[model samples]
Target: MISKAEAKHIWVLAEQKKGKVANVALEAIGLARKLASASSQEVWAVLLGQDVGGLAEGLIQSGADVVLVVEHPKLDTFRDDPYVDVLAHLAENHKPAVFLIGANSAGRSLAPRLATKLRAGLAADCVELSWDAGNLVAVRPMYGGNVLATVTCPEARPQMATLRPKASPRPVLDASRKGRVEKVDLGGLQIRDRVKLLESVETGGGEVKLEEADIIVSGGRGMGGPERFAVVKALADAFKGAMGASRAAVDAGWVPYAHQVGQTGKTVSPKVYIACGISGAIQHLAGMRSSEIIVAINKNPDAPIFKVATFGIAGDLFEVVPLLTEAVKKEMS
Candidate 1:
């Protein structure tokens, strides 16, 4: 077991895709900056990919005091075992005080594995974090998001946690902020790649990411049918935004699960979230309550969605949506 004195830095997983850094990784760095400042520890980002050493300087600027790059041909895609093994080796060698992984596709699968390998305490999907006399404390949603639980790892040397994307504030790009670029080696450890990604297919008509969208227009059961969802699509198109759906809309076969947003689905914190005909169930609100601005359009004046919405439109979506879409198009044009 490593002592607190042996653990010296805060490590942030720099998850990347298609040779570019994912937004969640930058968000992790932003969070690590704050946590490192509180604990008087240096912030380091673990960058692992082929030809990703070019991203180290950018990570340093993003908030990392040092960027640890593990470049190899076998580490191109999001293969689970190689990634976990490499990180485990790193943790065992250079013990960190805090280890943070973004709660995204790659991270969700990787966090627990790494934690178990290192025998470290892990907090999953934490939305908020604070320091209690230099110890890290994590706060996350509980009981279908009806409650928030604050957790601390008192027995672990290197505390581990996975943070949902957009749970922390994005840091401003500062080119002047620079640090060290470190290339880490595997020490002759043979990495056996079992999973081979043969091909990849892209779905969704509009090429927009729901999680990173600045504007999102979502439809619920009020859309009636997939055909009626055209108005919602039109609105999203007019704004050049992404399309989202409540669980009801997705379960009804109106849209795919990729568009679903809720407690059971994806948690999104877009800049502007427009809910069309959504009843605003507790589960749904739990996913998007963090949006910068929320607009609710529902026929029922007493709909719960209106309570959390920044703007309320008490009208039938069939009549209101088309007109609204046209107005948005006109305003933008």
Candidate 2:
């Protein structure tokens, strides 16, 4: 229970990829809104990139009360040094009550550094965040999903937590909400790391990132062989969704690491997730159990995937997938 006098504005470190707002940024803003409401404070978004102000309106629509835009030519590409300097500067100047960041590659890389710079306790990969009586509580899984730990940052002035991208609900657009924009000047930050983005290879036309896809078709060991992944891809294509794979399949070289979903991979909360031949280990379930609707197809009726599945089909995936794909294609046509 944060007192009215003590609580300051909530801040979200918004990330931009290829000149577009990352989905995780919106997710963080959504969670920020809930925290801000509880504390009676404004929700501020810190966006860093070249021409980032163009994205401020979208952030406002997604529930940000105010967006602090830090636009610099050196910040155009995501390099570690410049981003860390800017975020550290913001943390020192604005003095937010709580700072939320997405637990993605960039956030994971920067949050710990920023926390160290501020001398604050940092919680990473937190699945849930809330204010308890006045203290910020960050909850995360521990002991390989065996236990959950809730941490309270009491002494830290600005508590920091990074949330998994798909762990929260999407924010509803609020056109009436308004706030001011503060342009921060990155005074003397030099780009020390010379990682240049020469080219980007967009897989599968880059239609939808698996984390943000409304529908996902995932394969597992029962997918048989790497050659058979086309069947899963066909189904994903039929639904206009992205293709994902379980850790087992990915380790077996059946799919790329980018498409793997599990404890060691991406966490996703799609509207619909279809698991084909997946055994659904606890580690795998931790990644996508938050999906709105889970459809599991496995030859073994007792597969653990069926435990949390909204719908389960016990059958050979080789026999069921093609027929299901055809049915979906027919419906779409």
Model 2 per-residue lDDT tens digits across residues 219-331: 99999999999999999999999999999999999898999988998878788999998999998997888789999999999999999999999999999999999999999
lDDT of 1 by residue, 256-313 (tens): 9999999888888888999998999998988898899999999999999999999999
Per-model TM-score on C-alpha atoms:
0.94, 0.89
Model 2 spans with C-alpha error above 4 angstroms: 1-7, 189-200, 330-333
Give candidate 1's TM-score. 0.94
Candidate 1 C-alpha RMSD relative to the actual structure: 1.8
